[model samples]
Target: MSELVVAEGVALELRPARLGSRAAALVLDLILMAVLYEICYQLLRALAGSGASDDTVSALDIVSILLVAVGYPLVCETISSGRSVGKLAAGLRVVRLDGGPERFRHAMVRAMALLFADIGLPITLITGLPVLILLGLPGAVAVACSRQGRRLGDLLAGTIVVRERSETSPGTMPMPPHPELARWATTARVEDVPPGLILAARQLLSRVFELDRTAAAELTEELARQVAEHVSPQPPRGVAPYQYLVAVTAERYRREIGVNDPSNGTYRAYRGPRPGFPGTRTGARSAS
Candidate 1:
């Protein structure tokens, strides 16, 4: 349940694949690869035909064998957008650390590094301390301890294996209220803002307080535009873009949490900023 913040400021909680699931996927892939290698070996032997010249064995047959051993997962994962038969079965997928789809290069790096660590099949047979040591040593050890849950290959490839989840599952900041924005926050229907925009809003809200004053204004404006695309009715005239964003966020929070707005006691829970703390209200300066 750890979240990753991408460059665009979208926060997503990517469920890293467990070591057990990763091992299972590796085993399943190995079995398939071994079966494939056996079939290829048989075919090559037949073509080399017991007495065939060394030239054919050295050239075409060796190349074909190598291709089968390395090509299967590489091609499958790259073409399938980071999914293999084994990964599909294990409910896992390889994705960039930035939370984008894995590209061919990402797949290739992981595949090649895995070829070294796994030696194609060794990761399954070579269990116990060695495998963990292999992955948990160096850059991987500390990173693994972090939220990412990356292995050596994942580190080298700048990728990680994660179980996909709906974007809204890992919630963001609770509904912080604003007196000026509360009216709109209570009535807005943001349940349909789509996961991507919701993530953007959450990220903006969470990070806005940390940004430089002018930069924060620009950032919030851009984020507000993104959120407004999916939200309806728009903010009333003179509402600052940031206020619009907070209202939408609170509305989404209410929908997901089933909380009643204390005033009227319904699901529309938009109230003032914290009791004594002086925030919001006067900060909104945006015009229509």
Candidate 2:
């Protein structure tokens, strides 16, 4: 698992794609490329037979090869945020070393390295013949040698392939420290909170235990303070900041799913607060 520190010092654990999965995705992509190339070749032939100029036919042929063989990965990755058809099928994604989305330049460099050095498609196009030589071996070797399973293109582009899907479902609901806090949360107005802040708080809470105790406490306090600014009936006194944050998050989740309006009978998995908090107190007493 690779640990990536995102905004607000929240660290996320991402698993790198395995070699076998990467190879399978690559093979699938190569097969699709072959099919596309064949279609383009046929179209070009049809144009040539229709009395098209030799210069036009030859230029079109080069363009076809470059577009179908060399441009496939570049366009797909750039548009889909580092997911090609094969990668999407295989549940793999290309992300930067810091777990950010890959940019167009990263995709371009990777595609050039892949076609010229790894698969040798550009060389085959230039020679006007298929190269039976080591196609895909160089990239495979680079991935095998690298500890993080980085191929040549990935190394050049500052990207790494990671598994996007998890084996188990995640529980995203946050629970307040005390049951009575739920009552306060249900009545408290929370319509003014920014969506980004809520998302950040959720991420921070999910990985709270993995962080250092002191750092986690500080971050939670800071985030909770920010959340309080947008909430009404300011969090009750004698309660830790995280408890208030949890109550707000849980209330938001409940409202989002219409749990308050209807009896859906849907079960939710709520994560309780982390250890080390003091014992729970009585009713939601307002802060002075």
Candidate 3:
């Protein structure tokens, strides 16, 4: 079978998550807030009954609100590794714009920003409608214009909320007898493989069950050639064509196969028959 090679330098796909996911998160947050509000109300009432004054009561209310604001993000980040309860339930997370995990400071800044957007801005608009009418428009506009869907706080903190992609399953592709041959069977990381190649490989692999050996072999060979050309300057090195093909195939396999299993070691051997090869030379070789 001809091996499939992915193109170089493909842009990644990034899109806003579905409205349903966002809505679900919002609903969950509201429910949690309601519960907390009731608890705060009861606690404040008890404190007043025990001898607190009106001023104390008002101060406690502000403290309660602040606690809610802080708790939401802190709890989420600690429990779900940077995802709010709502985000966790919806399969979303707050990440840096660079696609890295977000820090607590960033999460806190985002949460505080959201609090201001939801509460402070509304209050300001109510108290000084004329001023808000003239100047508040820009604040809202700034948020909409920013990339990464960041608002003022998000922009300042360098954070963005994004939907998480599901992990690839193990043995998603058929196992090749040789590690070199199997390499072609494996897919590349989303960042490494071009979008077009990833899409093409997926489409081809999906219909692999229907393809005859001759057809599959032809497609694999053509794909291998393309990969060789794209990955040139670092193409597989060996004396024989089969060995070269196996070397290339192994690289692809590492990208595609997500499972960690004992069979992987055996399969790696069959892919290439070259001596002194990094993976196959040292370990147990599979029967060709």
**Minimal lDDT window, size 10, model 2:** 279-288
- Prediction 3 TM-score vs. true: 0.50
Clashes of 3: 20
Best by lDDT: 2
Output the better candidate (1/3) by lDDT.
1
Stretches of candidate 1 off by over 4 Å are 8-12, 53-65, 119-147, 165-288
What is the per-residue lDDT of model 1 for residues 3-57, given as tens digits with 9 covering 90 to 100?
7765455455556776667667777887887788778877877876888677876
TM-scores for all candidates: the values are 0.52, 0.60, 0.50
Candidate 3 lDDT, tens digit per residue, 1-288? 111222221123343333456557757876787688779867877877868888988888878877876677666765554577787788766655433356677877766766666334555656775533433243345545644444565576775555554311122333342544334334422234322233334434444335555454455344444434444343223322223334433344445564443235644333322233222232232211
Better of 1 and 2 by lDDT: 2
State the RMSD for candidate 2: 8.0
lDDT of 2 by residue, 18-38 (tens): 789998999999899989987
Clashing pairs in 1: 261-269
Clashes of each: 1, 0, 20
- Shift in Å, residue 236, candidate 2: 20
Over 4 Å off in model 2, which ranges? 5-11, 48-60, 120-130, 167-204, 207-271, 274-288
TM accuracy, model 1? 0.52
Worst 10 residues of 3 by lDDT: 1-10
Residue 43 in model 2: shift from native, Å?
2.4
